[model samples]
Target: MPRSPWWGRKVARLPERGTLIVSTDLQGNYEDYYALKQIYADEEERGNEPVLLLCGDLVHGPGEYFADPARWPDYLGTFYRDRSVDLVLDYAEWIDHAKTVALLGNHEHAHIGGPIVSKFHGDEAAVLDIRLGDDAPRVHDLFRSFPLIAVAPCGAVFTHGAPRATEPDLASFERIRYDGYARTAINDMYEEGTLGALLWARYAEPEHAQALLEAVHEGEGRHAFVAFGHDVVRSGYEKIGKEQICVSTSFGCEDRNKTYLRLDLGARYTSVDDLREGEEIRKLYPKA
Candidate 1:
């Protein structure tokens, strides 16, 4: 039986209209996760078509917990609870809905057959696997089903990390393969191949990102810009070079600096310049 294209496919092409909301590494902040969800739900209620994209890494929160949530000694003093387990459940549920799509982050890849990730626990994947228990396989399946990249008609390329790739073209990404994993798993995520660049590279040069976006939109012969999350951006969102934007929604930054991206998909954008903080690049918790 052929695998469903919507599940575990290397790339996803989004529609030309509606609203697209993008979130970066959730790494365990359940509060921020729901905050973003509210925005999505509100958009739908307001009669706007909404599309939600989760850019992976919704794992590895604080290892030790104190009675007080904010007492975890976090920067900017946040109530950082690792409700990753709960978020994982919600994440899968959202993807089950036709309007949501998830892109695999390096942390997610760690569990099934990608590089091992460690933030709080020594081996986050191993520890998380134990925590997941019988549900681990199901959770892994959810991760495996995530697309590596999502392209929208508005010329935005949404991915987990930097756009640099060892491969010459996007087709190489589709050719990635894995052995002894879910038939639904996206291929070669564990290797230092194209998938590695997409899942792990930070501080990637602007030209590098632009080139990859070009290839991504090459079929449509459209100019494209890159929007991704992997590294922390203190200001919540960063305009990288002329063609890329980086957002930090739920991890690696102060509570106020955490951010997401929201845009009218019907409008076409040519560069990161078109996005403004508090507008397209939104703060999950705004500072009053």
Candidate 2:
């Protein structure tokens, strides 16, 4: 098995590899949450292993709250908060699972992926302190703490939304600041008073993805595979050339009755879909 290319240093000891259960867009979908728990429990009973990775919108939906951060909690309400915390905490508690990582989606930004202003009712800092607390791998600080989770050796980049491809890989994956093309999106869509707020809106149209892939391939070194959620991809995965791959598992539970990607580190070095379709994981979550 190859090590994560993003690390590029000494290969960390690979654990006894197992099946990974990738999911996202619950957005307070408690039933789906419980179903996943049941699935994981069954996997454990059968002695099969499972891990989880989330793309975004884990808590509130896009329309659940206003863009203003100050009114975040008022919009989130107590019910939403409890559900979000519960689902996240459940994954952390899963002992037999390999590991878990989730990215902050556009819905998380109270201001809807705008500039880093004091938008949320408790502010980003206060929310992190209060909501996350002792969990070193917390969910609130998606960009700052766990921006990009790399699992496959072919340099897969796991992010919440479609990153501006032209941005430097290290910079895009390493910091809280939304610079480069994403920044341009913020400026053109919001700061300059553009008609449409592009950042707030998820990337649905294919032209934007084309632009993103062009930007991504511009970088040097081994290209990083980008996996994200937001756009509703019924099939759960999309490929740009042989390098960039995007997955949308949210459709399954809500409308399409599907789940997210399950990657196998021991698989061939290619797109995220390839990893998910690897013999180990597919045997369980077969795509019909």
Candidate 3:
């Protein structure tokens, strides 16, 4: 068995008794933001402090609605002028209270890809430059600073996507570290077709999930779980192998329903909840 990549990392430990809000593929939906805010409020009222783990794709890509040439300018301007500002403000508030960690999704990389930002600058200054202007550097730094992989105190691994092609054995996994910008970092897990499979793959094979579980268990010296959110699971959550779970938290044209996972680290339990506007949050856990 190989050693776990998280070995000897001081920040990898998730605090016992703390709650974790595992969310993914927000795609710049303010409704989802409001739902998260409400969830936080509810937890506070219950005297619990929780950490938010954003699995990635905080921003929606141009492909989402830009396929129409006629609506390109309108959509692009809205994202840069309106959505960008709102995203920053909302994220700021999130970071103000609970500890927040984010992973890079393909959408974030699209920002660096220059197409969206190219609409404004026409040059190569980047989208953050056009959208954020003087504040572009700070925003760029923020995105670039996101870690690719984060380990919870309970040893559960959280990522925007799952590792498939480069799925490391225990030894390789142990050597893994958080490098926001390095090629070897988890960020690159979805770069090439082979590696990017982690970020872009839609389904998880039972064998791969089981391999991950075994690696985490052997390397971390504890029973561990893995969670990812790139692929939208219409069912909300899917159990893979013995202890791996995959969830989709995005709400939009594809998935009209808003959902998120509330993980109770202390109880070693997780529940899926539905968030609907003007309605009470419905817990869809224990599978009816």
| Candidates' RMSD to native | 4.2, 8.7, 8.0
Number of the predicted model whose TM-score against the real structure is largest: 1
lDDT of 2 by residue, 1-288 (tens): 111221221111123365556565666455556766666567657766654555555654322254345554432321222244565555445422434455455545432333332423424434533555675244443333323333334334454555433333333424334333223344354332111222243343444433434443444223345556656555556665544455655433223335455555444443334554444222223433
Model 3 C-alpha lDDT versus the unseen true structure:
0.52
What is the Cα-based lDDT of residue 223 in candidate 1? 58
- Candidate 3 TM-score, C-alpha based: 0.65
Residue 275, candidate 1: C-alpha displacement in angstroms:
0.7
The pairs that clash in candidate 3 are 2-170, 2-171, 4-174, 5-173, 5-174, 13-153, 14-152, 14-153, 189-195, 190-196
Give the per-residue lDDT of model 3 (tens digit) for 127-174: 435656776665555565555555554556666666453444434633
TM-score of each: 0.88, 0.54, 0.65
Error of 1 at 149 (Å): 0.9
lDDT of 1 by residue, 151-205 (tens): 8879798889877753455676677653233232333442466677788787677
In Å, residue 163's CA in model 2 sits off its true spot by 4.0
Q: Which candidate is the best by lDDT?
A: 1
